[model samples]
Target: MSCDNCETALENLYLFLDEEIDHASIDEIQAHIDSCSSCLTAYDLERVVKALVSRSCAEKAPEPLRERVLYSIRTVQVQITENRGI
Candidate 1:
């Protein structure tokens, strides 16, 4: 991989880790990561970030708070669309 290819590959490293891309692109990105140390470091750091996010988000939601949120979300669907970048 050239520096540019490696850079792009690293930028999409999370998608690669989550297996969210097509097979052909996945193969290309994996191969690029295999040969690029900077990309490897990024991959490692991204994995750590995912782990922390997952671990820290394991708490239970309170029932009243959950109901309130669901009610507000149902009443304000536009806000949901906004948060989703639409």
Candidate 2:
């Protein structure tokens, strides 16, 4: 594995895992991971970590907290609008 390919794959690993990159870039990264054992291992580890994080973060906020946050956001919006005279 060329340093460049491994570097690029590792650098963009997050974007690739999150499906945030363009299709062309995804294809390029996927190809590198498929061909490079080291990158593939890195990719597998990152993927597992990401999945774990996503699962761990899947809990919803408590109802009271959710309501308070929404209220604060709406209050701020109203304040901004009032300040803008709109």
lDDT winner: 2
Measured by C-alpha RMSD in angstroms, how accurate is candidate 1?
11.5
Off by over 4 Å in 2: 59-86
The true-versus-predicted C-alpha distance at residue 43 of model 1, in Å, is 0.4
lDDT of 2 at 71: 67
lDDT by residue (tens digit), candidate 2, 11-43: 798899998999999999999889876667667
Best by TM-score: 2
Clashes of 2: 0
TM-scores for all candidates: the values are: 0.58, 0.63
